[model samples]
Target: MKLLVTLMGVAFITLATQSQSIYSLNYTMGFGVGETSDFIGSPSFRGVTFEGRGFLDDQFSLGGYFSWSTFYEKLAGEKFTDGTATLTGTQYRYINAFPMLFQAHYYFGTDEYEPRAYLGAGAGAYKMIQRVDLGVWSIEENHWHFGLSPEVGIFYPVGMDSQLNVNLKYHYVFGVENSLNYSWFGLSVGFAWGD
Candidate 1:
């Protein structure tokens, strides 16, 4: 009876030592730049975003995001019609986008510290809009858009059960007149357990 109990205890300890995991929800703030601002001849567009991440195990994670981006462009050649300027100094467009991505992390070769790298892909939809405003006239065009994304990130443990994560991502949106494309930087906080 004593031997059986001791073996069971040892097995449990070994299993626990080998299988550790973490979970987290992160919010990111970053900016984006347009790929086609040159054609519009306006100021480059940019905006902020928010994202969330969760850990599945010690070396894997799943993430989702919702972001709002506003891009701006300044018109160089201005024209007038009906006493109203055809172009304004700048143009504004906004996108409401969502993305789902998965990542695999590696946490080896460190001095008992947890530092990892991850990569993943994403696909989602966007609510996009374009607007033009003259001194005496204004117009707006709104539609639904979709896109794909690929990203990578690094995670470093900072506390007994928490981590600091840094992410770099790129997205290219299609199905529109001018493609929606940008890169973003993200900082995230997460918590871990087990192992």
Candidate 2:
């Protein structure tokens, strides 16, 4: 009975000593580099990211994140079939994507005032807007797919309640029709605020 009481006291003390941040909000803007398999040109993409996290413990956090990115490519004389005729000309292709995900993050090391590293993973919906322009004519389509993202990053303490954030992530969308599956490597830098 005495041993059980001692264990309960220790557990209470441990819980009381763990300090956690109430909430964290982060925003970043950057670019992604990748090419689609079916596209005829080498394309480039840019993105904006936003995240809001709540600390579950001193080292663990969970959050929801959303990002928007646009991909662009220009193709010269790409051939396509139109009924009984074949057409070829300069083509401009654009793909816009928005991903909303639920993320889990694990922060490593115990230094709150020093640079810290973290790894995270998320899965959610990816909404896509696809467009093609052939000078006088244009075609457009929209889709929604399931996707996942894996990330690694650093948090550099800049002030008492703010930090400089940098990260790299790989996003992949699955089960897309017409082989419109998308993937990219994203790099971003921004600021985070919390306790």
Candidate 3:
């Protein structure tokens, strides 16, 4: 978590010094896949993303991306087993994930007045906090996992200095030790500003 923060800070500073840069704040919706779905099947509407990108040229840019997503579910009178131990009760399960990544993107068009399509990918660390509550007792664990996200998006110019941005991104976080891998698809809608 510390490393992720430090890297994001440095990336932001570097982007701020660039002559041409863009910043965006997005509302994100997430759908869990595979093991993530098995744990929390509900779609997550509580998510947000912030990004800063420095243009290297007309078609390419490098950036820092940070996002938070929360998934939760309540199961009544469920059985849970861990090793030789077993518990039966109402379970409230939750997952909070933070992903901080360095990203690179390539734009397909150079026209300033028209919409531009882009392809991008990010790679870095994911901090996951998972918890389960049974009555008054709770079990919690935190882990840092390596992750990657591949994205496709469009930028529609809405004004001289602003654009409407929409994106579809997929996140994959690798498992560590005894933890299970997590995956999700995210749809983001936002506005971008800058040169």
Candidate 4:
């Protein structure tokens, strides 16, 4: 995880020194799906995204994307069966996920003053931490999985150098070993600025 962050920092600095680039900071809301929903059925309100894109042409761009999301739920007197043991108690469950990816995007209506729509995809790694607490006992697991994100969004110009950004994204993380796969949908609203 530390290595990935360091590499992304270096890449960001390198990209910033180059040609035209767009950067954004977004507030995100995530809804768990599949196995993720099976573990924590509640939607995640605690999330954020940071992205930087360097233009390769009028319609194509390459970027780096990073996001963090947390999902939590509490169940009272829930029965949990693990192996031959059956436990009934109040359980507190939590999932924290960080996704870092390299992204590519294609834009439409770049020359127009109206909103520009885009299709983008990203591939990279996801760090997931899952925890459950039952009374005095707690079980936690951490895993790293390869992930992909596909999104559709629009950039609405708000000023000379800034735009209002909105996007809907889906994240899919493949399982590792015997681990379970995870998936989610995210809606984001933010501001973007660039040359």
**Among all candidates shown, the one with the greatest TM-score:** 3
How would you encode candidate 1's per-residue C-alpha lDDT over 1-195 as one tens digit per residue?
A: 235334434533343344343444445443444543432333223444444444445445444454554445445445435655453344333333333222234443333256766676655555556565544456665655555667677667777666665666666656565444433333333333323
Which residue pairs come into collision in candidate 3?
none
Candidates ranked by TM-score, best first?
3, 4, 2, 1
lDDT of each: 0.47, 0.70, 0.90, 0.88
What's the true lDDT of residue 177 in model 3?
Answer: 77
Pick the winner on lDDT between candidates 1 and 3.
3
Number of clashes recorded per candidate? 7, 0, 0, 0
In candidate 4, position 194 carries an lDDT of 89
lDDT of 4: 0.88
- The candidate 4 region of ten consecutive residues with least summed lDDT is 9-18
Task: Give TM-scores for every candidate, taking all chains together and pairing residue i with residue i.
Answer: 0.55, 0.76, 0.92, 0.91
Misplaced by over 4 Å in model 2 are 1-45, 77-86
Q: Candidate 2, 1: how far from true, in Å?
A: 53
User: Per-residue alpha-carbon lDDT of model 4 for 1-195, expressed as tens digits?
Assistant: 567656766776676655889999999999999999999999999999999998888798888898999999999999879999998999999988999888888999676257899999988879988899989999988898888899999999898889999999999999887666999999999999988
For model 2, where is the 10-residue window of minimal lDDT?
Answer: 21-30
Residue pair clashes in candidate 4: none
Candidate 1 or 4, higher lDDT?
Answer: 4
**Which candidate, 2 or 4, would have the higher TM-score against the true structure?**
4
Write the candidate numbers in order of decreasing lDDT.
3, 4, 2, 1
Write one digit per residue (lDDT tens) for candidate 2, span 1-195: 234334434543443343544233344332443445365244344667877666677678766667777777788787889899998899998878777766778999767689989999987777778888998999887777778899999889999988888888788887456646677766767787767
